[model samples]
Target: MIEESQPGPGETPPALAVSGLAKRFDDVQAVDGADFIVRPGEVFGFLGPNGAGKTTTIKLLTGLARPDAGSIAYFGADFTRRLKAAQHLFGVVADGNNLYPELTGRENLEFCAALYGIGRAEARNRVEELLERFGLDYAAGRRFGGYSRGMGRRLCIAAALVHRPRLLFLDEPTTGIDVPNAREIRRMLAGLAADGTTIFLTTHYIEEAERLCDRVAFIVAGRIVRQAAVEKLLDGARDRRIIELQLDTAPEPLLSALSEHFPTNRWEPRAGKRLRLISTAEIELAPPVAFLAERGAAVLEARRLRPSLEEVFVEVTGLAAERLSAEKGGRRG
Candidate 1:
């Protein structure tokens, strides 16, 4: 059975719920019948390639654009009908560097507070507090344009939190960040979830979603294909037995022979003289190793491989595994 993000009957109200959501621009249908829900205080990830209606869906949810059809609810209240009344409950940080470049980090946050109708005195305190909380106090006086990519991203998040909203929407929060800095950003987000902040996040990083989200929805070709809790998703794939065999020579020559000898196993020769073996039946180490040894192939390594989020992503989305990193996939998305 397919697990859904919808709350069960008599369950606590969802932080956000979307049903039959759709949108079209000109001749192109950007989002089609999307459905999902975010539980309060949990980090919900929306994952897709570029232009897979991720941005459009965010716009629809944030009230920046209207959907052609569907319903959106926040805490059981109809958000589509009462967006302005519930504005204070939300904070949004766009994917790009929207914070003013010329302004100092502290000043930009203060300005955002003012826009949120925070009192001048309260805004001052909030700005300073956010700077320190985000580890931007040292560069709070520096122009935002001079900040590193990671620092700028943190400040943008701090600006979004100036009003201390309950629900925060973040787009590509860690895109293009260096290793140490990206890790820092992820650590900060985990802390937010711990503090009961509901985060609706859209990102290109599959591993990031697996790490941070309680639940995740995969969007493809402008449609939501699947949604489930991260643990359940991983648990479902845990039983899949995948074995990788490394040899001194390419495994292509052995494919036909292996298929003939072990018809129950699926074999594919990969790059780097490696072969992937998949089977539902038990895989014995002896037969294949002995078979390869007799065929003048040197066996280097043989190990069971764990399934990953990327594998499930490609499976559910029906995208070629090789195209996950390709630009054509983005265009199709």
Candidate 2:
């Protein structure tokens, strides 16, 4: 249990805080001087391209690995020095199946609770509740090794919550599951956050993060490039006034002529007749509409577009968001 070093009334401390965190493997720096604070009861997303030190950072935060240089605090108290004592404060959910494959789902949860020193009666009730809540009651007696990927993943999450940790650390929560299962897992995370559990998740799905996280941090090459509330990041994105045009003809060929007319704007072709004209400055529609008309290309539709979170990610990290999605076997979530 966490020590009762509570802050004075009305003073809310961050759920987790890190300063100057650094980790290295051989000659490569895995995590470089990372720093961030996680507020109470918020879903925080750590986003980055592959090899960006996201996994290493989570390991450090969860005490699975020691940092070469840094300070870590949990709710204002330094946790780095008291790692073992702080074990009960949070739970980790990653790729591996930590539960015993030989055991049944109910048995796995009961054993997890036992590890936390919960009483037998309490463990039984908690296990049953978790099994039902995760929709695993139907297969409670099934061996973990025989369970489907989605079922096992759900059980992994249930095992983490057996002790009801105050903070949860998850990595790529929905990387390889069916759409229905992924959606269910997202709903579980949303419910956890609503009930005041602080959640820190690293994900490749930019769409999922945008939908679920209260705040997000962009990490690149072992460093945290940016961290802010989702609304704040999107607000900055809103400043870019992109315009989308649906033309009668394929817009790819017209890019050259459009460039000559609107040299300052960037033209990108989408599928078929959809064209995106992106610019930071205000985009007047009349000129482009008139130009298209004069060229005998009908302007089927012309609408203003807001820069997407994926586009903003590319701007900050200089890495395409497609890389993350593509590696995860999905383009959107």
Task: Please give each candidate's TM-score.
Answer: 0.86, 0.85
> If candidate 2 were superposed on the true structure by all CA atoms, what would the RMSD be?
5.0
lDDT of 2 by residue, 1-333 (tens): 011223346878889888889999999999999888888998999888778898899899888898999988988789876677888999889866668999999999999999999999999999999999999999999999999888889999999999999999998888788888889999999999999999999987888889899988888889888888888888888878788789999887788999999998877766658887878888888898899789888889878765777767877886756677777676544
- Global lDDT of each model? 0.84, 0.85
Runs of candidate 1 with Cα error greater than 4 angstroms are 245-263, 266-275, 285-302, 320-333
| Tens digit per residue, CA lDDT, model 1, 157-189 | 999899999999998887766777778888889
Clashing pairs in 2: none
lDDT of 1: 0.84
lDDT score, residue 176, model 2? 86
For all predictions, the C-alpha RMSD in Å is: 3.9, 5.0
TM-score of 2: 0.85
